[model samples]
Target: MAERKAALNRAPARPELKERLERAKTIVLTEEQMQEQRASFAYGNAPRNSRITKASATSATKRIRLSDPQPVT
Candidate 1:
Protein backbone atom coordinates (compact mmCIF):
# COMPACT_ATOMS: atom_id res chain seq x y z
CA MET A 1 0.00 0.00 0.00
CA ALA A 2 2.90 2.34 0.80
CA GLU A 3 4.58 1.62 -2.58
CA ARG A 4 1.26 2.09 -4.41
CA LYS A 5 0.73 5.49 -2.65
CA ALA A 6 4.28 6.56 -3.52
CA ALA A 7 3.78 5.54 -7.21
CA LEU A 8 0.48 7.44 -7.40
CA ASN A 9 2.04 10.59 -5.82
CA ARG A 10 5.10 10.46 -8.16
CA ALA A 11 3.13 11.94 -11.07
CA PRO A 12 1.25 15.16 -10.39
CA ALA A 13 -2.04 15.52 -12.33
CA ARG A 14 -2.09 18.31 -14.95
CA PRO A 15 -5.14 20.37 -15.95
CA GLU A 16 -3.88 20.33 -19.59
CA LEU A 17 -4.26 16.49 -19.70
CA LYS A 18 -7.87 16.79 -18.50
CA GLU A 19 -8.57 19.51 -21.12
CA ARG A 20 -7.02 17.36 -23.88
CA LEU A 21 -9.09 14.35 -22.80
CA GLU A 22 -12.29 16.42 -22.95
CA ARG A 23 -11.30 17.83 -26.35
CA ALA A 24 -10.58 14.31 -27.68
CA LYS A 25 -14.01 13.11 -26.54
CA THR A 26 -15.76 15.83 -28.63
CA ILE A 27 -14.01 14.95 -31.94
CA VAL A 28 -16.39 14.21 -34.88
CA LEU A 29 -15.37 12.54 -38.15
CA THR A 30 -16.88 13.39 -41.56
CA GLU A 31 -18.70 10.67 -43.56
CA GLU A 32 -15.78 10.38 -46.00
CA GLN A 33 -13.32 10.09 -43.12
CA MET A 34 -15.57 7.47 -41.46
CA GLN A 35 -15.65 5.45 -44.72
CA GLU A 36 -11.84 5.65 -44.98
CA GLN A 37 -11.54 4.50 -41.35
CA ARG A 38 -13.89 1.54 -42.04
CA ALA A 39 -11.84 0.59 -45.13
CA SER A 40 -8.64 0.79 -43.10
CA PHE A 41 -10.13 -1.58 -40.47
CA ALA A 42 -11.42 -4.03 -43.14
CA TYR A 43 -8.15 -4.17 -45.11
CA GLY A 44 -5.60 -3.38 -42.37
CA ASN A 45 -1.84 -3.12 -43.17
CA ALA A 46 -1.43 -6.54 -44.81
CA PRO A 47 0.35 -6.76 -48.18
CA ARG A 48 -2.03 -6.96 -51.19
CA ASN A 49 -0.68 -10.36 -52.29
CA SER A 50 -1.45 -11.95 -48.87
CA ARG A 51 -4.89 -10.38 -48.41
CA ILE A 52 -8.01 -12.61 -48.69
CA THR A 53 -10.71 -11.91 -51.32
CA LYS A 54 -14.43 -12.89 -51.12
CA ALA A 55 -14.18 -15.39 -54.02
CA SER A 56 -10.95 -16.94 -52.70
CA ALA A 57 -12.49 -17.24 -49.19
CA THR A 58 -15.62 -18.97 -50.53
CA SER A 59 -13.56 -21.34 -52.78
CA ALA A 60 -11.30 -22.24 -49.84
CA THR A 61 -14.36 -23.06 -47.69
CA LYS A 62 -15.75 -25.24 -50.50
CA ARG A 63 -12.37 -27.02 -50.93
CA ILE A 64 -12.21 -28.06 -47.28
CA ARG A 65 -14.89 -30.62 -46.40
CA LEU A 66 -15.70 -31.98 -42.89
CA SER A 67 -15.57 -35.64 -44.02
CA ASP A 68 -12.30 -35.27 -45.95
CA PRO A 69 -8.96 -35.08 -44.12
CA GLN A 70 -7.15 -31.78 -44.69
CA PRO A 71 -4.26 -32.23 -47.15
CA VAL A 72 -0.77 -31.59 -45.70
CA THR A 73 1.05 -29.03 -47.82
Candidate 2:
Protein backbone atom coordinates (compact mmCIF):
# COMPACT_ATOMS: atom_id res chain seq x y z
CA MET A 1 0.00 0.00 0.00
CA ALA A 2 2.86 2.38 0.82
CA GLU A 3 4.64 1.61 -2.48
CA ARG A 4 1.45 2.22 -4.47
CA LYS A 5 0.86 5.51 -2.65
CA ALA A 6 4.41 6.71 -3.42
CA ALA A 7 4.05 5.79 -7.10
CA LEU A 8 0.73 7.66 -7.40
CA ASN A 9 2.11 10.89 -5.87
CA ARG A 10 5.26 11.05 -8.06
CA ALA A 11 5.43 13.73 -10.83
CA PRO A 12 6.70 13.09 -14.38
CA ALA A 13 10.54 13.32 -14.61
CA ARG A 14 10.78 15.57 -17.69
CA PRO A 15 9.12 18.95 -18.25
CA GLU A 16 8.07 17.93 -21.81
CA LEU A 17 6.36 14.78 -20.48
CA LYS A 18 4.38 16.87 -17.95
CA GLU A 19 3.48 19.42 -20.66
CA ARG A 20 2.29 16.63 -23.04
CA LEU A 21 0.14 15.11 -20.31
CA GLU A 22 -1.43 18.49 -19.58
CA ARG A 23 -2.04 19.15 -23.30
CA ALA A 24 -3.76 15.76 -23.70
CA LYS A 25 -6.08 16.47 -20.76
CA THR A 26 -7.05 19.96 -22.09
CA ILE A 27 -7.85 18.81 -25.66
CA VAL A 28 -11.63 19.17 -25.73
CA LEU A 29 -13.26 19.49 -29.19
CA THR A 30 -16.61 21.05 -29.95
CA GLU A 31 -19.35 19.06 -31.73
CA GLU A 32 -18.69 20.84 -35.05
CA GLN A 33 -14.95 20.18 -34.81
CA MET A 34 -15.55 16.51 -34.00
CA GLN A 35 -17.95 16.13 -36.92
CA GLU A 36 -15.42 17.75 -39.28
CA GLN A 37 -12.67 15.42 -38.06
CA ARG A 38 -14.91 12.38 -38.56
CA ALA A 39 -15.84 13.51 -42.05
CA SER A 40 -12.17 14.00 -42.98
CA PHE A 41 -11.31 10.47 -41.79
CA ALA A 42 -14.22 8.89 -43.68
CA TYR A 43 -13.21 10.55 -46.96
CA GLY A 44 -9.50 9.87 -46.36
CA ASN A 45 -10.09 6.09 -46.58
CA ALA A 46 -11.12 6.32 -50.26
CA PRO A 47 -11.21 9.01 -52.93
CA ARG A 48 -14.55 10.12 -54.45
CA ASN A 49 -14.09 7.77 -57.48
CA SER A 50 -12.68 4.63 -55.75
CA ARG A 51 -14.76 1.44 -55.95
CA ILE A 52 -14.26 -2.07 -54.47
CA THR A 53 -14.72 -5.06 -56.78
CA LYS A 54 -15.53 -8.66 -55.70
CA ALA A 55 -12.38 -10.03 -57.40
CA SER A 56 -10.17 -7.48 -55.62
CA ALA A 57 -11.71 -8.31 -52.21
CA THR A 58 -11.55 -12.11 -52.77
CA SER A 59 -7.92 -11.91 -53.91
CA ALA A 60 -7.00 -10.49 -50.48
CA THR A 61 -8.28 -13.63 -48.64
CA LYS A 62 -6.44 -16.94 -48.11
CA ARG A 63 -7.06 -19.90 -50.45
CA ILE A 64 -6.89 -23.65 -49.67
CA ARG A 65 -4.48 -25.88 -51.65
CA LEU A 66 -6.56 -28.15 -53.87
CA SER A 67 -3.61 -30.54 -54.52
CA ASP A 68 -2.67 -31.24 -50.90
CA PRO A 69 -0.30 -34.22 -50.39
CA GLN A 70 -2.40 -35.49 -47.47
CA PRO A 71 -5.91 -35.25 -48.79
CA VAL A 72 -8.91 -35.53 -46.43
CA THR A 73 -10.28 -39.08 -46.56
The sequence of per-residue lDDT tens digits that candidate 1 reaches over residues 1-73 is 8768777755778899999888867666554444455455545544688766544454444443344323333
Please give, for residues 1-73, the per-residue lDDT of candidate 2 as tens digits: 8768977876758989889887767666554544455445555554557674334433332232223233222
**Model 2 regions lying over 4 Å from their true place:** 1-18, 51-73
What's the CA error at residue 33 for candidate 1, in Å? 0.9
What TM-score does candidate 1 get on C-alpha atoms? 0.37
**TM-scores for candidates 1 onward, in order:** 0.37, 0.36
Question: Over the full model, what C-alpha lDDT does candidate 2 score relative to the true structure?
Answer: 0.52
Q: lDDT of all predictions, in order shown?
A: 0.56, 0.52
* Residue pairs whose backbone atoms clash in candidate 1: none
